[model samples]
Structure formats: structure tokens, C-alpha cells
Target: MPYPLNHWLATVGFGLAFCILASGNRLRAEEVDFVRDIRPLLAQKCFTCHGPDEGTRESGLRLDLADGLFGELESGAQGIVPSDPQQSELYQRLVADEDLRMPPLDSGQRLTSDQIGLIRRWIEQGASYRSHWSFEPLDPTPPAEVEAEDWVENQVDRFVLAKLAREGIAVSPAAPPQTLVRRLYFDLIGLPPTAEQVDAFVADRDPNAYEQWVDRLLASPAFGEHWARRWLDLARYADSDGDLGDKLRPNAFGYRDWVIQAINADMPFDQFTIEQIAGDLLPQATLAQKTATGFHRNGLKNTEAGSDQELDRVVRTVDRISTVGSVWLGLTVGCAECHSHKFDPLSHRQFFQMYAFFDNVEDVDLKTGHGKVTVATIAETKQRRETFVHLRGDFRQPGEKVRPAAPEFLHAFEPRSGKPDRLDFAYWLVDGDNPLTARTTVNRYWMHLFGRGLVDTVDNLGVSGEAPTHPRLLDWLAQELMRQGWSRKRLIKLIVMSATYRQSSQPRADLVDRDPQNRLLARQARFRLDAEGVRDVALRTSGLLDHRIGGPSVRPALSADITAYSRNRDWVVSEGGDRYRRGMYILYRRATPYPMLQIFDAPDTTASCARRDRSNSPLQALTLLNDPVFVECAQHAACYSDWQTDVDWIPQAFRRFLSRDPSAAELARLRVFYDHQRQTLAEFTEAQVRALCGESFAVASADQHDLREQAARYLIYRCLLNLDETITRE
Candidate 1:
């Protein structure tokens, strides 16, 4: 049977109050911010018919630009008249008759009354238009002081508290020591803290106890293991060449290990990016540097019997351009591949210009360790290939040739030579003047720490993307990242040490009607663990995890049905200890993924995944109770220590799985459940007991009392692991 929904919900404290609190009751800011308020509305509703694309723009009017919006329309009428809603054709048509509406009768789109009012108020306020929030350079001005000086721990807290003060919402108090320690462990190392570690932290009297723990975890090798999974998702790192045949990429793990090592070493962000983009082009490049170039080769490839090889190469090139655009610049440049972007400033010619940098690179398997191992990497071709605009994104319809360069809308790209290459492009990406890279990078790390980023839409920071909830805070953090020598560890340490990150995640009844999404950062966010993180927690708690550092990927045991999906059908489960490695080392076959990981929302690795979807489904509950790995975890965790010898087994189990002691009522109810399960197990047959408890329980004993008690304890452990709190990170 699936785990009881009510039982899980009750444990996690996400009942009716949470549902009502999550209702859509968002309150707008007192003063209208042009980028935050007006741009999104224009981009979503007005821009489609009157924005960027010249071909589809109606009446030769562009609402996206100020000159266009304030200029006379084709009908010789002012499109927008500042401070006069009465004279503005924009506002006039918005409230016009159905037949003469701005969107027209057949457009099937209409501005709501509230929206129309906002436009009127905006016009009455001078119809201001600011540059897109993300395009502007980082603001060097320090954060403004907040009234709640006592609550501030750092600049991050100052910004958050200032926002909360403006919203008339009080910041939630600092989380309890128990909650903080567990949250820090999971956030930093992606593992649960042992009971002893939790006890020590709680008992420590030193004021630097929390900061010390942060330093220790950041220094731990596990930090790399935990953080690399996030980058690999954006890199689309996979074990197989994804397509119908699904052939394996044997040397892919070399790049994966390089990332782990680089992050563990706290490699500067600028150098990290430079190496991956054009490491092989560096003078006297080392083997490790060449492996870093594998970032470009992680995309899908086709090697079928009948295929368009040239087109396949072109597709890979397109993937490279799109990946760089999304990962570094946070722009949807792919939209401009066939035509000019209808939202952002990316143009068709500019997209090809960016593509030209990657066009000359070709994949090569580099031999390492005296030819015993191969690393998948890229190198510049002996004869560079010219880049042409793929007319309508079709390789057969090539248009004008373009030279390598950065987007014109961004900072100038000055190559060292007359002909620029990937190396020059890499330098261009990390250049101080490029607005997107530092901000986008800082946002990525922020999203991983908090449940959401400062800018909620992480992948897109263009005009259409959501504006930063705290624009000043975002810029402050970005500036700090660059000033600190681009050290990710230092930035992460600074964030976790901040009072803003350490706030209790409990829902506020007062803010229920005000801040539904918690964009104001009145409290920290509570969310479920990432899919791989869920498995890592189970393995670590069960004492089955191999904490060894990086190496080649391993094939964990999969059901025959899952294995059948692979073309080779040669999945041999790793021997003994290798089977218990962390989920990061699991072979990510694109066509045939590991069942448990995929069920928990693991990305398929076909494209850049900025953020993963966290889903709650009955299948997830069922998997925890029935899947072989999780079942084994429950049995081992329960039977690892002698439960019968301990009177406080329930409390012990709670700490082991949840890193906390149960409440009086929670302990009482769990004890009753244990007693009921003992009685149920007493009547079960030996075969049935063995099936439920596994070999770890030793059900063959002549003493039936022991079997009953062991089976009951095993079931309780399963129950604990299945609770919503077990997988959730509060």
C-alpha cells in the first residue's frame, strides 16, 4: 500500500493552513517599478503584435522601445502621451469597444480591469521606461540601512529585512539550533547529520559554532560531490550518446571528475569557465585542461545506419551555442536561430556570430595515463569551418556568413587576433563589463541555497524574464563575487552565514494574505530535496553509501524491464561496494534512466536544466515503500543497531532519519503504531516476515518473539523514511 497522505501531510505541517497560505493573494509594490511591473505586461500582451519582430509587428509600431511607443503610429496618432491617459492612444485602445480593442476582437486577449488601471497609473506617473533590470551593470551602491538593525547579520540580511520592513511583514525568527544544523548539513554536504554531530552542535557554547561548521563542510570533499551535480545538469552531462541507438560515451566521467576536482579546489570562476570553453587551445595545456573541454561535447550525437552526418554536426553546433547562451549569458539566444528574437535583443545575425566561435571546434578522444584511459574533449579544427546563418534554422538553407563575436547589445568583444576563436569568446564571457555572467552565476548559487533565486526565472534574465525581487541585493552579491576573486566557496559561506538564510521556514499567518510566494524573503523557504539528494540522504543514513571521491560511472542494479530499453542490454550491476556509491556516479543513460532517481524528477540531460521540478506523487510514496533500494535502506537502518536493547528506539530512529527528536505526541503515536505492527507481525508466516524485513532482520530464528519485534522495528523505520519530513529540507 502507498504511504498515507494524511500521515505524511501531518508530519510535514503542510495542511489546510499551508494550502490557504499558498493561495494567490500577492500584493503589488507601493511604487511601480517599470521593469518589474510594466515590462512583463508589455512583453507578454502588447509585444506579440507590436514588439521586436518587424515582419509581424502591426502598424509599424514597436511597444518594446521608447522611441516607438512615444512616436506617432501609422495612423498619425501618438501611441503614448506621458502624464495624460486621456490623450494616450495606448490607454484609449485598451478601454476601447470590443471591435476596436488594442488586441482586436479576434486576438482572444484582453487586459483585465486591474491591468488597465496599472497602465493608466503608469502613464499618469510620466510613463517611465527603464533599461531591463538584468542588462544594467551591477550597482556599486551599498544596501540601504534597515530599521531592524538587531536582526541584520550581513548585507544579505539588510536587504531582506529592508524589503520585509517595507511590506510591513516581520522576519521570522532565527530557526532553532536543531533545524539550523540539519539544514546546513543538507544544504552544504547534501547529507543528513548523525545524532552525535547534532548533539555536539546543539551543546556547543561558542558563538562561532555555526560559522565553524560552514567552514568545515565547505572544506569537505563532499562539497564538490554535492555541488557538481547542479553544474552537470546545466552541462547536460550524460553517459550515453542520446538518440535511438543510445550508444555509450565511455570517457564522459573524466569530465565529471574534472568538475568535482575543480570545485573541490575552489577554482576561480573565471578560470573555471575559461578552461571548459577552450582549454585545449591554451598554450601547453595539461591533460586535465583538455578534459575540461568536454563541456562542449556533452550534447546529443547521432551515429545511426542512415543519418545526415553534416546536419548532425550542425545540430551539435546549435546545441553548443544555445548551451553557452543559456548557461553563461542567461539569454534565450536559441530563439533567434531562425529569426530575430521577438522578446530580447538577440538578432538572427548575432546568433550566428556567437555560433561562429564554436563552429571551428571538433570532438577528439584524448589519450591519458599512457593511453590507458580516454577523455572526451574538443580541439580547434586544422581547417576552420565558416559559419552561416541557417535560414529558418535549416542547414540546407544557409544564408549570410558571419564572423565570430559577442552580441552587440552586450560589451564589445575585442579578439587578440583578426580572427577570434573560442578562447577569445571565453575571455569575453568573463570580462568585467559583461553584465549577465556574474549576476547569472550568483543567482544560480542563490537558487541552490534558497528554494528560489532572487530572479525567480533562473535561465532567462532577458527582458521577458522575471525582474529581481531585490535588484540592489542581486547587484551587491554579484559585485562581491567578482571582488572576492570569483570564489564560489567564499560566496556560499557568506550566504549560509547570513541571518536571511538562517530564518525559520514556518508559514506566517499574518503574511498569508500579503506575500503568498514569499518573494519578500520574510522567511527562508522549505522545499523537498533534489532527486539525487533524496537518494544520497537515504544511502548516508542507511550506512550503505560509499563516500569515495570521483571515478568512472557505475551501473547500479536495475530491473530487467528498465535494462531492456538500452540498445546494448549489457548492464552488469557493480560488485558489492560499488553498488552503494552516491547517485552522482550512477550511469545516466538518457533513454533508460534509473527508476528511483527519475521518479523524483531527475533531468533527462537532453538540454540545459536551470532548475528541476519538485513533484509530489503517489508513485514516489510507493517507491519508498516498495523499491528494492529503499526497502533495503529501511531494513539496514532499522537493524544496524539492536533496537530491542534500546527502550527509546522511536526517538533514536527519528534522529537517525530526520536529525531531530520527536515531540511528546509524535513519540506517543509512533509507539502505538509500533505496538500494533508487532501484533500484526506475530501472526505472519516466516516467509512473509522475511519478505518484509529482508535478510538483515534474521527472521529464521526459532524464537518468534525476536522475529515479531524485528519486523515491527523494520516497519517503523520504513514509516519514518516515508514521512514527508524525511525527504523535505526545511
Candidate 2:
């Protein structure tokens, strides 16, 4: 049976202690930690009606605050009296009669008997509250020592091993050289390795060969193209306006190209953040910086006649605020627009204060001729407009006026010279004293590399978010990111070089039962490639990639049925090498994305998507088997000439596509498949062979016998492309 949600969350939140408890082991009196044990339980069960939002709080009481819970309540009783569980109303209400129980039956939440016992014991010991983990300042101490001295490759490994030691689990050994090299190639560049490159690294005996290979891949131009796709998800980038018309925007490619160039140059992340947010407001800003301001212009715009212009503009403003909150601080600040935040300590007034910063941006629609595109950009006027709270998120009814400011719950933003604006907002985010920005950014990078973040909810680090399994390690990484001058490349290099990153993705038989999610870092994780990475691997392995840097987005051929789904579609397929560019450069229409990417779970570009879901389904399998792109890739892969005999091709094909030679069993299985296909092709008549090879084959060759040979080889290529290992990043 599957574990309960609270039980699983407790296991993730408390690390080893919860593991022991869930295994039915007895817990000592000294092991109960209020922050780790009691806080999450209250936040999940009791906080919704009794916590941060003042409008919904019950009985003039708040359980989330220390003073409110421990002090006297309006009912002439204390909710939580230190060292006295019998007198504490908090404990009494939990074990009360069904009708008077906390989290009343209608609320669809109930505390288990064990949970009640835990609370009673916690209050009996003394109810001590610690600050929420993410809100505390980052810890700057070194990692704790571990028992496995020789296993220590860096500070990252020390922290990971120390946790495993506490759980009585051992770390998995390093993966073989073939698996290591393949993992490095996909992780760093988002492409598969060439057979020759794979062989060279496998044969190299030097101890530093792996590090040298990492440096080489990081410096490659493809590295920028690969990483840029990740940032575009947060930017909400699309080639067309989303609603009714879905009209195209031609100049959005400028922002896309800017991201690639910035990452390739190893731009300091602080400067990168500043440029994207306030580049247009800077005095004498460069053309590239102005283009960077296009980040805000990427939101959806309604161009249809008779639309509500004022309401549309207000929605755009909310999108910017919500995106910034999620992308920078990992908070769902948007939840406060209608009322005070129900979970985090953000009031409705603070939401409008941040909205004031974006209200002055001059972005109005321009009329253009049919099929022509116009650039959407940021331009500010001399006078800034005042911002107000929309009563219950209604644009028609406005409440109290507000000036520009950051959220009050975080570090205070004190201006040094002039009135605070968006530029000031950007600087305040990256300031060392503020806690969330660096930690959030490093967590995102960790997710990209390790298949999961320390805090699994990458977009929210608020009260509603999951607690980090290793809180100290997350703080250390955040401090290290700031100490390195906010250099993204430097931080990435350190993570990839760590011993924790080098562990085998294969699970240990002993630990899988205890920690299936691998939150304790007992082993590496294996996951399917992202949508872009999946397509790019097939293109590179088949030698069909263009390798050209960014220019304009490409329109590859799509099925007629997919094109007809859109009402105002005008997709003209790009000619020549443009059709073969990397998947990131494919034109993305918000209403109707390319079918292959949509099937593979690419973001819809409607909001800020910090992470994309990896789904496995029959449609994905069918697309790889029948899509024109994959079929063309297969044909191209079959045309290469390297093997001497018909059977000699199988192992070489495996090495080229999978980065390793096939085993004896796999080779024997594939040889039978190859022979069956060749015999089927030979039996076909001349006219049947011509029909099987499309019109493109007619132009290339008229010989029926040769076409039969190539078609048989194409069958093998198609099968290789469909293997699970080919698309996974293990």
C-alpha cells in the first residue's frame, strides 16, 4: 500500500528520525524537535483557518505565531502552556469529541492518534518554536565530518555522506566510465556523444580526464544553446500572442538570442537578473540590455477587437508580479492579491506595493499589416502612475494607494540615493543579506543537474512548500553562490565536480525500501531527458543537426491535421538547413505548439514554469515511431558507411546511438530482427519497393535492389531510436 501524504512528507521533512518512526522504531524523549516534528503537522492540518490570513482566522486566535498560541486566548484559556499538556487547549482540542475537534469534520482533515500523541509529548516537554527554515539566514559553517574519509571528494559529498551515516545507509559506488561520459555529455551540452569521442574518453587513463572533459564541454557553444531552453520556460517565451488571434511576434527571438549569449559569456547572475528586470531604465543602456527588458514583454496580449483593454493590461501586470515572485524568491506572492497570504506572511497591501514598480512600463499594442510582425518592447514615460489594491482582485474597484516596495517580510530595502524603482528592486533581490534569491537560484541549478532539488518544490519556498531534507547543505550552497561573485558557471562547475554528482544512478538493493525518492542522497537518480534534449539527441546521433547559433525561430514541417486545429494559422515551413536547427529554435505558438514537443511535455508558456513534467505515455511512443522528423533521422542514420559485414553494423549502431557497445545477448536479439527485415524487403516487387520509399527516394535513386537494402537498414535505425535508454539521461 502507498504511504499517506503526511507520513511521506514527514519522512522527507525530518530526514532520519521520521524514517525510524515510520519503520515502527521507538523514539527517545530527547528526539522530538518542534521545528521538524510539530510545525509541519500544524501547518498542514490547522493553519488554513487559524494562521496568516486575518480575514479567515478563527476565534481571535492564531496557532502559527508563538505569542498567540502560548499566551491567554479570548476564551480565558491558553492554547499551548509550556510543560503542561493537560492544561493546554491546543492538546485538548485535538483529542476532543468529534464535533468540537480541531480541523472540524467538514474541513476534510483529521489528526491520527499517533499525531495527537506526538503533540501531547511535544507540549509536555516544552513548546519551543524555531523560525521557519527557509526564512533563517544562511548558515556559513563548514560541512560536518563523515565516517567515510576516502569518499570525500568535496564539501557536497561530506554533507550527503553525513546524512546517509545517520540513516545507516551506504552510498552507491561510482558508475562505469561509459555511463559517466554519457551522463556528462547530456548534462553539460544536451546532446549525445559521438562514438569516437566516447571511445577516446573510455580509453584515457589519466585521473583528471573527467574534469578536463567537463571543462571542454562547458566551453563548447552548444552549452549555451542547451541551458538557454531552461531559462526560456521562466521567461514565458512564445512566438505568438496567446488569446483569440494568436498573432505572431517576430522580435521575441532577440530576447532568446540574448539569453544564449549571456550564458555563454558566463555573465554574473546578479547582473543578468538586473538587466532582464530594469535594463531599459538604466542610463545609456546598451542595445543588448534594452533587448533584455523584453523579458516582461513576453507575456500574452489579446489583439482581438472588442476586448477589455484596461482589464487585459491589469492581468499583464499580475503576470509580471507573480513571475518575479516565483522566479526570484520562490514564493506564491500572487496568492495575496485578493487577500492576505493564507500560508506565508504577506499582506494584500504588500502585493500592490510591488505592483507599483511595473505599472509605469509603457507597453501598448501597435497596428500592423497582415502577416507582418512587430517587436514588443519596454519603454517608460516621465510620469509614473500610482498603484492601488484591487478590491477582491477587481480592476473596477480600487482600494488604498501604495508606492513601490519589496515585500516587508524579507530584508528591508533602503534606498541609497533616489526614489526606489524596478532597478532598486533588482539590486535588492541579489543583495547578500536577503535570503531567498541566491538559495532559489542555486536550487534551480541543482534541479537541472540532479533530477530533483533539495527542496522538491523549486517554485515555492514559503510555509506551504516542503522543508529541505538537508537544510544546512542548502544554506552552504547559497552562501557559496554569493561568495563566488554570483558567477553561474563557477557554481555549476563546482556541483558537477563533486563526488555526490558522480554516484551511480542504479539504486542499492538495501536502501531502496527505506528511501525510494532518494531524498537522503543515498544514490543518483535516473530520469528521462527534457523535451528539447530528447529531440536534440536523435538529431545529433543521426548527424542531422545544423549546429548553427540563434537567429530566427524555425517552422519545421507539421502534419496537416495539427495545422488545421488553429483558426488563424499561417505556418510556412522553413526551407534548407533551417528545418534542422535545434529544438529550442522551433517556433512556439501558445495556442498550438509543435505536436512532438507537446507530446513530450514541453511547457505551455502560459505562466512561469520552473520545472517541466516528465511523462511516459503511448502518444509519446507513437510520435517517435511515426513522426516525420524521427523517420528522416532514421533514414539519415542508415546511410552512414562504416561497417564491413551486414551483422557488424549492430554493435556500431548501438555505440553511435547509445554511447556503448551492445552486449552479447542484445547483439543476438538484434541480429534476428535485422535478418527478418532484410528478407521482408527482398520479397517486395519493384513497384512495391518504390511505394515504400517515398518521392524523396525516387529522386535520389531508381535502383530497386539498393533501395531495398537501405530500407531494411532504416528499420534497424528506427528500432534503435525507440529504445528507452536512448532518450533517458542516465
Which regions of candidate 1 are displaced past 4 Å?
1-21, 45-50, 54-61, 71-79, 86-117, 564-568, 642-644, 695-705
The most accurate candidate by TM-score is 1
Error of 1 at 279 (Å): 1.4
Candidate-wise lDDT, in order? 0.84, 0.81
Which candidate tops lDDT?
A: 1
Model 2 stretches with alpha carbons more than 4 Å out: 1-37, 75-77, 96-112, 364-375, 566-569, 640-646, 698-703
- lDDT score for candidate 2 against the true structure: 0.81
Q: Quote model 2's TM-score.
A: 0.92
Candidate 1 local distance difference test against the native: 0.84
Q: Could you give candidate 2's per-residue lDDT for residues 1-730 as a string of tens digits?
A: 1122233223321111111212322222365677668877887888778877777888877777787778887778888988898899878888889888888988987999898998888887777777677777788678898889898888988888888888888888887778888998898889988999999999988899888999999999988888888999999999988998888887678789899999999888999999988887788987778778788988898888999988888999898988999899999989988988877778788888898889888763332232454445676757878788888888789999988898756788875556788899988888888899988999999998899898889999987787787778888999999999888888888888988898899966676467777788877778888887878888898888899998889998888887776542478888988888999999999888888998889999999899999776767666776777887788787666453445787789889988988888677767776777679888998677656644444223566666777777777777777777788877
Q: Write the per-residue lDDT of candidate 1 for residues 159-256, one digit (tens) a residue.
A: 88877777678888899988999999999889889888999999998888888889999999999989998999999999998898778887799999
RMSD of 2: 6.8
Residue 424's lDDT within candidate 1 is 92
